[model samples]
Target chain A: MKFLCTRCDEVMKLAGAQAGDDTVGLTFSCPKCGGSFAMLTNPAETTLVKGLGVQVGGRSEPAPLMEVIQSSVARDTENQITWDPGAETRLANVPPFARPMARKAIERFAESKGIRTITAAVMDEARALM
Target chain B: MRMYHEVAGDGGSDILGQVGKMMERLAGRLSLIKSVIAVASPKGGVGKSTVAAHLAASLARRGARVGALDADLYGSSLPRLLAPEFIGANATRGEEGLFPIAGVFGVRVMSLDYLTGYGARASVAWAGAGGSITRGPVEASALRELLADTQWGELDYLIVDTPPSVGRLGDLTALVPSLAGVVLVSAPTLLAYQVTLKSIERVRALGVPLLGLVENMRGFTCDLCGAANRINVEGEMGETLSIMGVPALGALPYDQRLLKPAGEAGPIEAVERIADALLAKIGGHAAARA
Candidate 1:
């Protein structure tokens, strides 16, 4: 998206930017007339830009791989499943690569059964189902 | 007063530059891989995923470092077929990026199922102000992120199993920097042949090499007699293949053993032959390019 300074009939350079709770303000200045203006983006527009995984004003550091997905996915706390010591020990036995997936499966199994806390029994039940 | 004029660049966002960086990351990661093959078919329920899973296993059985990427976001069945135990499992992150889970035959596997933790039945709905209208762009972004993020270490072959859509095939071609080739899958049906021909045209138009076609479920081999029973009027598909000038890699007969568990010796012999033919075709294609 480009900005044209109608008063000066010249292209506007991005001067600065500020990100708010649900909006983004981009300030631009005309090189010919030294005039400036601010463009504020709505929540939806801000989200669309965010989804592209790019920063408004160039990025200082390269964005990490899958940063957009990793940030947007549901957090573990949102699921509301806690694990007991025994279950945690069992989970530790899984290989590091598969551990996260195993943990998610166990928590999902426990949640489906209306169980708030995951124990060794729940882990076994999930294993049996698998 | 003069008239206003639009600028040439993105004003300063450099969204295009960022996207270029993303593609660079993907290319840098894929540089270590020797061949990137995509098993695609425009029509579904034709064993594209099955062929992909078995092909990866077969390639690995040949001692090649293989990685199977389940590009089917809507229905990622490669996880269930290759590593059922890893279903509902979340992808683990590392200092570099997300890790691809090691599945059967030591083939590295990555899919949206791992990232989303929704397993095989993930109903991926992208909500936006435009409702269902934004699904295409959303899906493209998700695929781009998946390709850019997963840390696939050194590999001999990375076989991508694409969903049953010509558009998805186009997306893969556009996303992957240097695709080795594409293996179009087709059943022994006239309908499949028609749609697959269109896919063949699309691939050619994109200038990606076609690695021949695998005729799956062409016939059934009788278990008791050890005799192959010919299914579908033979020569119909042959005529079509001849007309299209696409090589027939091999015909996979319908086997009951494939329905059995993964470890229990199911169709490896047939799949190995197909794998060999694919390698030879890829070699020839590379030679021709050279």
Candidate 2:
């Protein structure tokens, strides 16, 4: 199987069949960028896929959705507030390329603080941290 | 739904997808060599390239299929150093990749000099229009791709001649994470030793095994009387090596015979000794597998 580094764009070839099982995870270091990433056996023969097992920097944390649900529901039982108009406006200011990561970070922050309704102030604090 | 739902719900962005594709490409490139050795120094003009060429030649002479990769992009010297004796017949191209030009003693060679047609005059005039290659993300990417794209056939060893800098050392380590070892070259001068120590620290920080330090130009041999006089600050260099906790592989005296196109055999013997020490330090393919 082949893997390309996100940072340096250099291709690495690994013996995918060596992994054996379909669910096998292979950890490799990019010779070019020195970045470490994991790949799992792809269902299609001779292919591989990412995201099923990728843990950069060796840090493992709670799932993003789990963090949000626990933080938001723990404090306010009935707080189901959606994005405030002001918050949406601020989110629009985020670049399209980074919008997804920025938005997820903001949601996690709001859920942690028991803020079900995201306001401009929440976006302000999220923007600050990022 | 989460706040990021809309953004992520539209699948991932094109940029993220592109990054994923690139990462996959990096993972699939494989090396054919059994052991990869990098020869580096933090400062330039310490005979790092000379040491690399000789090491490659020494290994090849031993019937080991060795390949010398001149990683010094801007100021390449391998082609010039070995060109007289090791002629580049021609670089064959195919669907796989360009074949490395064969050098002296049947050692396969690859360098930017061959690509730019610069040969040994890379340091003097890399480009005709005063063009200079700047260091940055783009250049770094290009270097990485160049290394990955090379089609090196099966070999016993691949000696990489790295540029003088900590960054290039890091990049090489990243490119070949399973490096057999790093052989540092330095002259017996205060400045060169100081920078070499920094390189030692950088290599250690990267967790790459350092084979040992080679004190190049440790002394001068007089051709008239055939007397070898050790240069000054030898004791200080020993202290630096002690502080760094790396063994001194060998000390190569300054031999004027190396300046010629066809290098003399005497000085090259010193390089072979260092290569022997490095192989001993590697402890066979067991350490290489580790």
Q: What is the TM-score of each candidate against the true structure?
A: 0.83, 0.60
lDDT of 1 by residue, B62-164 (tens): 7889998988877888887777767667676665668888787778888887776444554444433333443455667777778768888899999999999
How accurate locally, in lDDT, is each candidate?
0.77, 0.61
Give per-residue CA lDDT, model 2, range A1-130, as digits (tens): 2345667655533322234433446566667766776665443321112221122222233222111112111122253335677776776676533443455566667767888778988888877887
Model 2: residues >4 Å from true position, as ranges?
A1-130, B1-6, B9-29, B85-90, B117-135, B232-235, B261-267
DockQ of each model vs. true complex: 0.36, 0.01
Output the lDDT of residue B165, model 2: 83
The candidate maximizing lDDT is 1
How far residue A104's Cα lies from its native spot in candidate 1, in Å, is: 5.1
